[model samples]
Target: MGRKHTPFTSLSRRKRRAKTLHIKNLIYRERDRLGGIFFDECDQVAALASGRWTWSDIIFLSQDPAIFWNAEIITANVAFADAVEDIAFNEAFSKLNAAETQQEMHLDFTPDVSSNGKRWLRKPALKYPQFDGLTFNDFIDKRALEIARDNPPAIYCGYRILPGYASGIGLQIVVEADRLNRAVIETAIADFRARGERNWISDVPARVCYSDKTICTPLKIKE
Candidate 1:
């Protein structure tokens, strides 16, 4: 006989789908807004480099109609970005807090990687006009550094196996985020689980053991 589907089961599945869709939409909206800001910043940097306008002049012109309109757009974009970040952080905090347990906690910290497959190692030490003298490549580095400052790495709490242990363990994994958001936590958990599975291949013994404390540690991702 085929298994029966209850009305409650159907409703639960629909709710899950709705929640997933909502999260995805939030991620997409955030990406779009941030991308827009990035391009706008890049353009502003380029213009500043060309000596088209000084920061002082730009500040003074803030009340000009054209400049004010541009400022309004950027302001709206920033507001949206802030709203999305708040939502993501609140959801992440609640989820992590709910997973708190009495197990020993291990720490994992890794450097942030860029889309170009390079590690962002430079610390954010320079400010606006300092960046004005930078080359295009250096400008990108400065931008990344500023982003790191704004979105300090997110630390995710979860359970995982320690490096040499055959048993599971609790861990606090620090993941670098271009933007501190819930997606970072989700990715960290998935990566941690994948590393645990890979390590298990070598740790197999005469008897397989499992424990509630067993959590997987993340393997370093190669640059």
Candidate 2:
């Protein structure tokens, strides 16, 4: 025989349903917040890729602790680093080939005359490969190259959190795929909140890289 339904049982069921709905709503809210952060990070990467800013400019902007703590932001930071490295590598490859031929690459800079005509205002040259019809600076910034070479931006592998506040936490924020889905959103939200709650303190901000094995250190922000 089946058991009879009771008012108490109905009430308990309603409460369970209500609690589940609340948690679902909370997850959705967190997802939206994380989605926003992810897009903002992508925008920063786009700006750098489009030549709106230099590697130095991006590095300087990323130094803020607020930017570094989040998983989404770290993922974007890794993307930006990869983009810069690719750019530098391509430029070097092209130059090496061009150098072998000993082709004289012309400087594309057009000197603008000063108001008094006493001096010329030289605009910063674009750091890109020379094209057949286009021109580029003949000289390369050795210092910039050195910085890029030595401190190749690390990939966001994973993170580590110790028991005490003094030990601090290490996070390697990485998003393997380009596409964002529910799982990615949930993970991002969790990591972000975890880092925030921990309040990791340090003299220098932790440097994240693409590789899991790399020893996290502070990046040299200044060029």
Candidate 3:
């Protein structure tokens, strides 16, 4: 059996144990550093990246919302006892493990060779940006998304792992957005998981579940 799954909310009786999402050092480039309250956390990031100069740039960038999200890498790992608690798991998780879905419950992370996952697959590692003036937050914002998409080289971030106790699996999704929202992020994660390779991403078996209790999962999303 895979790891026990609890909701990603606070620890609850229904969800005995669930793992939380984590990030190594997510970055936010100005843009009202305090505005991204929707994010899972602001711990890995430093506070100095905001204030006067930061705010100015964010305002300037806002003029063009196309690239608002630069980069952000949230780390994650599979824990058999508490795998289902992750934000990514719960987002599409509930849908993936539906009681009356036409698909199989034990789905594979690896998709066929024609899938995007296969097109952009690589070993686990981060892709740091080389921009001269861009701040750390900017790098995480910009390059992280590029890497997540895997334009050329593939990246295996912690977020892309299954909710199980096993090893040899993981995924990294880079996106643009100073603050990554859990609800939206989870939605995107689920989307990414749906049409990709079965072997490259995380692997685990989960069934639909719902309860009135808070899940025992952390708020953070990356390593």
Task: Give the winner by TM-score.
Answer: 2
TM-score of each: 0.19, 0.26, 0.20
TM-score of 1: 0.19
Best by lDDT: 2
Judge candidate 1 at residue 103 and give its lDDT.
17
Instruction: Give me candidate 2's TM-score against the actual structure.
Output: 0.26
What lDDT does model 1 reach? 0.30
lDDT of 3 by residue, 66-140 (tens): 211112233221121123323222333343324423243333244446785565443222222333455333443
lDDT for each residue of candidate 1 in 12-66, tens digit (9 for 90 to 100): 4455345434434433444453231111122333333443221110000111112
Question: Which 10-residue window in model 1 sums to the lowest lDDT?
Answer: 55-64
The whole-model lDDT of each prediction reads 0.30, 0.37, 0.30
Query: Sorted by lDDT, highest first, which candidate order results?
Result: 2, 1, 3
Where is model 3 more than 4 Å wrong at Cα?
1-168, 197-223
Model 1: CA > 4 A from native:
1-11, 33-172, 175-223
Q: How well is each residue in 1-223 modelled by candidate 2, as lDDT tens digits? A: 8865432223444553454344344334444533323212233333334432211111100122222222222343445455555665456446545553343344333445655565566445444444332234333334234445676544443433322111111233444433334345446446546555443333333343332111122232211
What's the lDDT of the predicted structure labeled candidate 2?
Answer: 0.37
Order of the predicted models by TM-score, top scorer first: 2, 3, 1
